[model samples]
Target: MSAVRGLEHVVTRLSDSCGQGHSGSLLEAPSADVLSCSMQAVVYYGVPGDITDVLPRIGEAGIAVWGPQDGEGRDMPHARGTVSYALTYHRDHGRYPDGSLMSTPVLEAAGMRVDWDRPGMPMPSRFEGFVHSCDPDGGHPVYERCSTAPKEPMSMAAARDQYGTVLTFSLGEPGSSAYQYFTVPRRQ
Candidate 1:
């Protein structure tokens, strides 16, 4: 089967298994936070044989995969001789602010400043641009930066106090357009 077809098959099997609520099922429904926080679906699967032929097909499908070693650097358990992989698919919603895109020049032309020296900010070279909407109360534009590097973590309170309402952050994935987008509400 084609890569896309293969992925569809995997998704179908997983969906069926989860819907059945079978004990010891490999996949489970995502949490509420995972649903709200991002526009992506991740599926984990294990195979009882070498994936040498499957890897190329997965690459052609442009799906991000993580396997063998998990987040904690431990080898994924896959019986006596098997491989496990996590496939990530990012869903495209639409453009921000009425489908009109913004560039770096446009933001600068509008008198909005790019704060580069903020702690945990990505380097200038990795900066892509910004997507912003005006704060109606004061006609100030709230900006969100897109970058190719991950920013250091900061508390929500600290970020709001420092950047006002919107916090500048990075989503670093080499050669991928999955930019991280976050918005913090104004402090009450």
Candidate 2:
């Protein structure tokens, strides 16, 4: 099987049996410099066919896709979140005049590299251990953190907010990275 076929299969299986809806997204680390590419594909279950057309609306909201020559465009493929196979081919260049793709693999490969090394950060297994706790803010929960501390106690300091809430972090020493997370109440 092809790699994309495998990727599609994995994405499909993950979208099918796991979550509450038919939504899935992929995020890789390191973009812009091209050492790694962050890819995201999301499927929202029970959504209308129009639900999938949101990217263009977002484009209309003042974002531009620069096409293959300028290098900031996206070629979306296989975006069917409605009933099975409602619309097999749905690629629209609505807000982006130059946004189109002749091939999927070629476009996605623009950022994918074989020699990429995954950057490691000290991730928390639960919501705790975050120097500053905040809401999901708008991302998926791919990691957990300690409610109090990590499995191994590594010395890290906390910078508290005005309310005495911890909001930021700095490693006691260099050469270490952390996956910090937290929640902040909205100030209306």
Candidate 3:
């Protein structure tokens, strides 16, 4: 399937699993320099309480959930919890529709390589063995911290390179601390 279509399918499944009244929108990499070869989307919804129980439902829809780490663990007390998904897709005809090259710096930082010459290859899975930090101060000293910590301010190119074409689903009250914590910065 085409990358866009695949992303749409993921959105649909997530919406279904999460129930009605949710909204979705397209998201672009915050930086012009960090172009992706695929489309991106984000789904937003409200949860009456903790989202812990809803996680299994999300998993049933075939998306992997990376973390449900609480605010205390990540040093962000305002956030009840946070989770992330590394959306993946296979390139159509082995290339981006606009023929853009994935950011090399992002791949290098993640210790990954993309075989640009190969057609219809699946995007590489996220580099393993690192946990993203949610420290609001962006001063976590963990050795295995993910390069793309959400709460930390990052360059647009860096965000694009790390997330690529992705679909994010956020659960929380709009304008609440949890919601703000999940919001990614658009400027460098």
Ranking by TM-score: 1, 3, 2
Deviation of model 2 at 114, angstroms: 22
- lDDT (CA) per prediction: 0.24, 0.22, 0.25
The true-versus-predicted C-alpha distance at residue 27 of model 1, in Å, is 39
**lDDT score for candidate 3 against the true structure:** 0.25
Query: What TM-score goes with each of the models?
Result: 0.21, 0.18, 0.19
Q: How do the candidates rank by lDDT, highest first?
A: 3, 1, 2
Clashes of 1: 0
Worst 10 residues of 2 by lDDT: 9-18
Q: Whose TM-score is greatest here?
A: 1
Model 1: which residue pairs collide? none
- Tens-place lDDT per residue, model 1, 1-188, is 22322221111000000111112225763222211111111121222222333433543443332233457744355311111221111011212345542221100101111111222332242111121111121112233222211233333344334433221212222222231223233322
Q: Candidate 3, after superposition: displacement of residue 164 in Å?
A: 29
- Candidate with the larger TM-score of 1 and 3: 1
Candidate 3 lDDT over residue span 1-188, tens digit each = 11212222122111101111112236642232221111111231222222233333443443322334344533122121212211111223222457754321111101111111112232242312112222222222222111232333333234334434332343322343332222222234
For residue 185, give model 2's deviation from the true position in Å: 34
